[model samples]
Target: MKKWLIYTFAIAILAVLALQLFMFSTIQQQKNSDEKYFNMAKQEYKIFVPYIPDSLELFGENVPVDHVLVRERLENEIVRNMYWHSHTILLLKRSARYFPVIEPILSENGIPDDFKYLAMAESELTNAVSPVGASGVWQFMKSTAQEYGLEVRTDVDERYHLEKSTNAACRYLKASKQQFGSWTLAAAAYNMGGGALKRDVDAQKTNDYYSLLLNQETARYVYRIVALKLICEQPFQYGFFIRNKDLYQPIPVKKVSVSSSISSLVDFAAEYNLSFLELKNVNPWLRSDKLVVNTGKTYEINIPLSFSHTKLTENIADPYTIFKDSIVVE
Candidate 1:
C-alpha cells in the first residue's frame, strides 16, 4: 500500500508538470502570433495612396501619375520623405541661405523662378558629383561645362564657381526655350536635349509632355522638379520649420581685378590685407597656387573687406576663436 501511494504521487506530479509545460508553450505561441499580426498591420498602413486632383485631364498626354501604379509609387516616396521630418527641415533651412545667391542669377538670365528647383533636384543645393564626372550644384560634366563656356581643366573647374555656372545654365536655358518655344518644354529639355525632345514630340504626334512615353528618368524629372518647388515654396504646408539665422547668408567681400600674372597669390593676398584662404574662398575659379596670367584674360579676385586689423584688435576679445571656423571656401 505504501509503494502504491508513492507511485500515485509521482504520476500526479509528472502530469501536473506536463500540463504546465503545454500551457506555457501555447501562451508563447499566442504572443508570437500577436506580434507578427501587429507588424503586418503596420506595414499595410504604409501603402501608397495617390492624391486625386480634380483636373486630371489637364495633365493629359502626360505620364499618368494619378493612375493606380504611379500614384502608389509617388505616395510611397511622399510618405517616406514626409515621415523623415528631420531631413526635410534641414533642407528648408539651407534653402533660405542659398536661394538669395541663386535667384538673382536666374532673374538676370531671364530664366523662370521655377527653374531654381532644378538645382534643388540636381544637388540639393549642395556641391555634388555624379559617376559620369558631373560636379557642383549644377552637376556639369566636362564636355557640357566646356560647351557652355566654363573652363574645365586640371587646375580650373568653373563648375564649382556658382556665379559662372549659373550664367552658363542661363545661357543653355535661354537657347533651349528658343528652340522648344515653351518654358515647360525648355525645362524638360534641360535633362533631355531640346532636339531629342522635338523628335519625341514629332514621333508621338503629341505636343503634350505628359502624354508621350519617355524614359523613366526623363518622365519623372519634371514632376520631381514641380514637387520640389511645391514643397520648398510652402515649407509650412509640408511640415518643415526653420529660423532666419539658420539660413545661410552670403559674406561681404571686395573685388580686386588683376590683368597681370600673379607670381605668388599668397603674397598678393597679404598685400591686400587678406589671408590666402580668404582669397581662395571667394575666388574658387582660380585653381592654381600660382596664377598663370592669361595676358588677355582679366581675372577678378575677391577679398573680404569687412575684417580690418584695427577693428578686430579693438573689438574682438579672441582672435583665435574667429579664425578657428572655416569661412566659405567655394
Candidate 2:
C-alpha cells in the first residue's frame, strides 16, 4: 500500500511539471506570434518627413529659402499642411471648383496666379466669416470690403460674392504691392494690415519681408501660402493621391439679369424650376429671403445650367483642366 501511494505521488509531481512546460511553450508561441505582427505593422505604416524643394518661388519673387529661418518656417508650414490630411484634401477638392472662377479674374487684374493660394490660405475657398466680422472667401472686413468697392449692406453684401470679392482682393493686393514694393510684404500686410506692416518695416529699417520681425500670425502667413502652393501644385509628392473624378468640378451656370425687385425669392426660384436653397447657394450675396433692386440697378443672378431653360443631355465636362497640367510627379 505504501509503495502504491509513493508511486501515485511521483506520477502527480510529473504531471504538474509537464503541465507547466506546456503552458510555458504555449506562452512562448503566443509571444513569438505577437512579435511577428508587431514587426509587420512597423513595416506597413510609415510617417515620412515632407520633402523640401531646394528652390521655391511665390508671385515671381524668389523665396530666400537659403536663409536658415526662412527654410525652417517653410518646413513648419509644409509639415503642418502635409500631416493635416483632412483639411488639405478638402482644400485640394475645393480648389478645383473655385480656382477656375478666381484665375481669370486675377489674370484680368494683373495679379499673379500665386495669389489664388493666398485666398486658399485665407478662407479655404469657402464663404467663411471670421469671428471679427471679416466675411467671404477673401475674409474682408466690412470697412475694407466697402473701401474696395464691395457693396456691404443689409439686403446685399457683396463680400460673399465670389467674383466681386475676388476683384476687390486684386485691387487691395495691387495697392499693397505698390506700397510695400514686394509681393511678400504685400501678403504680410494683407494679414497684419497695411498700417501695422508699414510701422514694422519702418521700425526695422528693412522692407524685406524675410528680414522684418512680424507678429506670429503675419510671420507664418506667407510661408503657409507658399507651402499650400507647393503641396497643391505637386500633391502626389506630398502623398495626396486623389482620383480626378473625386475632385469637385465647377458647376455650370447661366446668368439671369433682373432689373426689378424679387419680392419672394422662393417664388422666383420656383418660377425657374429651382429650390430656394439652390438659388441662395448660387447667390450667397443675396442676404435676405427677398432681393430689393433699386431704380436702374440690375442684379445678375446665376442659375445652374441644368436648372435653367437650356436643355442638357449629359453632364458637363471637367472645367478644371489646369490640375492635369499642374500635377507634378516625382
In candidate 2, which residue pairs clash? Answer: none
Q: Give the alpha carbon lDDT tens digit for every residue of 1-330 in model 2.
A: 999999999999999999999999988767753355445435645568888878888999999898999999999999999989899999998997899999999999999999999999999999898989889999999999999999988889999999999999999999999999998888998999999999999999999988888899999999999999999998767867554545776767899999999899999999988999998888999999898999989999998756432233134343222244443212
Give the Cα error of residue 62 in candidate 1, in Å.
Answer: 12
For model 2 the local lDDT of residue 234 reads: 85
| lDDT digits (tens) for residues 158-262 of candidate 1 | 898888898898888889878766676777788777778999988998766656687777777766665665566554345433323334445567778888877
Evaluate residue 166 in candidate 2 and report its C-alpha lDDT on the 0 to 100 scale: 97
Would you estimate the TM-scores of all the predictions? 0.66, 0.81
Model number with the top TM-score:
2
lDDT value, candidate 2, whole model: 0.86
Candidate 1's displacement at residue 281, Å, is 3.3
**Candidates' lDDT values, in order?**
0.67, 0.86
